[model samples]
Structure formats: C-alpha cells, structure tokens
Target: MLIGTPTEFGAALERRRRELSLTQDDVASAIGVNRRVIGELERGKGSVRIEIALAVAQAVGLDVDLSART
Candidate 1:
C-alpha cells in the first residue's frame, strides 16, 4: 500500500496486526516498547518516533519501502 500519511501508516499497521492475530501487547513485548506506545502509533499520533513506529511495523510483519514519486 502507498502510505502517504501517519494515519495511513497506522491503519496499515493495525490491519496487519489483526490479520496476524497479534495484540498490541504482543507487538510491544516483542519490540521492547510500552503497550501505550503501540496504541499511540496505531492511532496515528504524529509524535511517535520513526524508529519505534518502524519497529512496530517490523514486529507485525510489515515492510516499508521507499521509492521516488513518479
């Protein structure tokens, strides 16, 4: 999916997490982050650190690819 906004990223993460049958706590524990952080990221909180957000995506089996706009 082409995610252009924080909200889109968060929604994708949440959808993948659900598809994988993972709870927020499961992702948090795997990534060594607070559960609340997961919630915040899933809610599209713009303040979420990019590293941490990416970590959550990784934990949920999501990949972020960067490409130049055509």
Candidate 2:
C-alpha cells in the first residue's frame, strides 16, 4: 500500500469510489457536502480538513485504520 501524501491516498480513494459505482455527487451527499468537494479531493487537493476527509471515508464505506504498517 502507498502512504505519505494526498496523491497516494487520493488515488486509492478515487479508485475505490469508482469501483463501487459511486459518483462525486452521491459521495458528497453521503458525506454531507457538495459534489465539488469530492471533485477537489479526487484531484488530490490536500487543503481539505481531516474531519471532512473522515466523513468522506465513512461515506465511501472505507474504515480508517490507524495501526502502524510493517
């Protein structure tokens, strides 16, 4: 798995979202935001706040595991 910056994380998130057949608008509603928010995130914009990111993750059915990886 990749780590470090928004590119890796954002790419993974976008891929998963697409795999699930979800549009930016769908995810935005589930996460309580506008479609533009998801678009910005998919574009790998790191200006997003962590809380919003977490909400997006939740909306996408992705769990945030904070355990250290080996």
Candidate 3:
C-alpha cells in the first residue's frame, strides 16, 4: 500500500526532529517557514501544501521521497 498524507508525514517529521534534538522553530527556520506552520503540521491540521510538507521533511532530516514503482 502506498500511503501518503501531510498529517502522517508531518508526525514523522516531528518525530525525526525530536530524535535529532531539534525544535519546531529550528525546523521552521531551516525551511524558511514560521513555527506555527510546524505546529499546525504536527497536529495534522491538513491545510499545508505537499511541497511545504516535503520542505519540512527535508529540513527535519525525515525521509520524504517515495518509492512508488512497484
């Protein structure tokens, strides 16, 4: 199953950030976004764009790429 959602990905991103000792502000700064964006994402608000989510994943060192070729 190919499962992808901003909320799920965002939660993963948050987990990775914490594992790396990074705060929401840290990720926001690295991704050029506001801390609220990170908070909203982590909470699964579901209004953020996919590109932004990818940016968050990258900034937080989370694996964002998909291996869709099955």
Candidate 4:
C-alpha cells in the first residue's frame, strides 16, 4: 500500500500486527526497539525514524517501497 502520511502508515502497521497476532512488545523485540516506540508508531508519531519504521514493517512481513517525491 502507498503510505501518504504517518497516520496511514501507523494504522496499517497496527492492523498487520493484529493480523499476525503479535503485540507491541513482540514487534519491538523483533525490530530491536522498545514498546513505547511501537506505541508511538501505532499512533502515527511522525518523529519515528525511517529506518526504525522500515524495520517494524519488515518484522511484520510488510514490504515497503519508498519512492522519490516529485
């Protein structure tokens, strides 16, 4: 899916997490982050690092494609 905003990314992440039956802590551990970070990501916190967010997506089996902005 094309993520146009942080909120969209967060919601998608949360939904994927639920579909996998994984918790915030589980994703955090998988991505080498803390639960709070996961919470923030789930809440659409725009400050989340791109690398970390990508890691979270990877951990949850989501493929991300970051295209160049025109």
The top-ranked prediction according to TM-score is 1
| TM-scores for every predicted model | 0.97, 0.85, 0.79, 0.90
Badly placed stretches (over 4 Å) of model 1 are: none
lDDT values for all models? 0.93, 0.81, 0.79, 0.94
**Which candidate, 1 or 3, has the higher lDDT?**
1
Worst 10 residues of 1 by lDDT: 55-64
Instruction: Give one digit per residue, the lDDT tens place, for model 4 in 1-70.
Output: 7788899999999999999999999999987888999999999999999899999999999999868989
TM-score of 2: 0.85
Write model 3 residue lDDT over 1-70, tens digit each, in one string.
Answer: 2336666666777778899999999888988889998899898878987778879877776664567566
Model 3 lDDT, residue 34, Cα: 93
Best by lDDT: 4
TM-score preference between candidates 1 and 3, better one? 1
> Which pairs clash (backbone N, Cα, C closer than 3 Å) in model 2?
none
Q: What is the C-alpha RMSD of each candidate to the true structure, in Å?
A: 0.6, 1.5, 2.3, 1.7
1-70 per-residue lDDT for model 1 (tens digits): 8998898899999999999999999999999989999999999999999999999988888888999999
